[model samples]
Target: MTRLGDGVRLAVGTLTAVPVPAPRQIDRAVAGVAMALGPFAALPLAAAAGLIVLGGAAIGLPAPAVAALALGAVALGSRGLHLDGLADTADGLGASYDRAKALDVMRRGDSGPTGIATLVLVLLVQFGALTGAISAGHGAAAAVVAVLCGRCVLSLCCAKGVPSARPEGLGATVAQSVPRAVAALVFVVAAGLATLAPGLPWWRGLLAVAVGYAAAALVLARCVQRIGGITGDVLGGCVEAAVAGALLATA
Candidate 1:
């Protein structure tokens, strides 16, 4: 639990220019904590809840506007973990040949052409899905459910057995600390609760999980093969891709 607090500090540090503490220090300190409840995944779920509560007022707004606001809240809250991951993963995968080079590319902290293309494509897909869902009268429930369940996928990915490319990297800590069973429980419970809301069918929410899992398996498998295993950035990418995929599927 305390580690989660440390993870929170790390997350806060990443988002803001504020220097609270060393990220690697906080990362190590929060290893157990992050394992317990999920890290960046938790924040997006929280943001989704806020979006759901605000949906009544948001309903009148354009789908893109509402989605932008909600995504803005998530980006602000988590400090762009997913976006950065999305970028890094794109750059690395596009530029690298094998595990070592991919991991090296990801560590460069600079976006490449692939990263730019990925960012643009995902944004278009996300906004388009949001617009379609809202137009179809499912945005409020679908987006909320997708966000939470996407985090469920994040937790699940952390729990899976995958070798880290580098012994000292973020993936190593997460892979070692997170228990698959605990992560599974988080996914099941969160998805169940999110489904219990008034406007949505429970089956639809469960379907979102199915969609997420399928996507995660495919993406993470490639990630593991290409980079030797997952990292904080990959985890962030997983959440974003899963959530967006779920929203589009459920829509």
Candidate 2:
């Protein structure tokens, strides 16, 4: 039970900008447990964003403005980790088809034209979809569901059968750390929660979950094929893309 608490603390510390103290030690087992709790760690981020949306709506703010603010809140809460990953992945994929070269590009601390373009397009899509959802009276629910699905992809990416791109770093530490059964259970729970989100029918939420899963799967397959395995960047890209896909489905 103490170990479980530590794992949850680690997940909250690493995955969000929350000021939780880090555990004294983090090993493979702890990281695996943390990865399994990824979706739960995202609750604060989702809640912050949801509050922004609800508050903005109560004040007669435009849907676009509300959505942009909500996105800002989420970005701040998560410290833009996923967005950074998305950019790196794009730069890697755009630089070359060769696995080695792509990995090298992703490792560099710079954004290229492709990365910039990808970020712009993805943010635009998310903003537009969020605005539409808010206008349709589903702002808070959409925000929560989208953020939760984004974090849920981390578990899927780390599930057994997925390989790490490198032998070190976060990607390797958590790679294949989650069992397939656990991943499936997390997915089902995420879908169930989505179904209960405000202002949406259960079927719509389920459809959104399906879209999120499809988006994550596509990203995962492409990363495996191009980079030889999953990297931290790939995981990050999956989260952002999954969120966009979920919001779009809800819209």
Candidate 3:
């Protein structure tokens, strides 16, 4: 029980900017819990996003602007970790067919053309889909669902058998850490939660969850093909893609 408690704290600390105390001990068991609990740990972020959408709509802000602001808030909440990861992953994938060169490109701080282009395309898609959801009065629910789905996909990415591309960093700590059963359970829970979100039918919720899972899987498969395994950047990219897919389905 203590280990599980510590694991929860670790998940919150890692997944958010929340200043929780460090875990007393860290191991594969703890890492698995942390990744598996990512979606629940993201509850605060999800609530903030939903509230932002609700408040923005109430104040008559344009849906597009409202969604942009909410997404900005989401990015800030996570310290822009996943967004940067997405860009880096894209740059890495597009950099070179050679694995070492691709990984080297991703390690650099600067955004290259591929990174810039990917970010633009993803941000535009997220913005457009979110804008539609807001205009349809499902903004808050959609926002919450999208955020949860994003984090939920992280568990799947880290589930057992998903190898880490590199031997170190965040990827090394978390890669293949989660039990496949746990990952599946987390995703199922996310889908169930989505079903209860207002203004979204159970069918749509299921569809959104399915699409999110599919998107994450595709990203993972590509990462494995390109770099031999998953990495922190790839996991981050998966989160963004999952969120975009979930929002699109919701809209």
Worst 10 residues of 3 by lDDT: 102-111
**Where does model 2 exceed 4 Å of error?**
none
How close to the true structure is residue 220 of candidate 1, measured as C-alpha lDDT? Answer: 82
TM-score to native of every candidate shown: 0.82, 0.98, 0.97
Alpha-carbon deviation at 3 in model 2, angstroms? 2.9
Question: Which lDDT tens digits does candidate 3 get at residues 1-251?
Answer: 97798889989988889889999988878989988989878999999999999999888999999999999999999989888999999999998999999999888857899998998899898999999999988989888998989999988999999998999878888888999999989988888878888888888888888898898899899999989888888988999999999999988
Q: Cα lDDT for residue 107, model 3?
A: 83
User: How much is 4 displaced in model 2, in angstroms?
Assistant: 1.3
Return the lDDT, model 1, position 169. 67
Off by over 4 Å in 1: 1-32, 39-45, 48-59
Clash count for each candidate, listed in order shown: 1, 0, 0
Candidates sorted on TM-score, descending = 2, 3, 1
In model 3, pairs of residues that clash are none
Candidate scoring better on lDDT of 1 and 3: 3
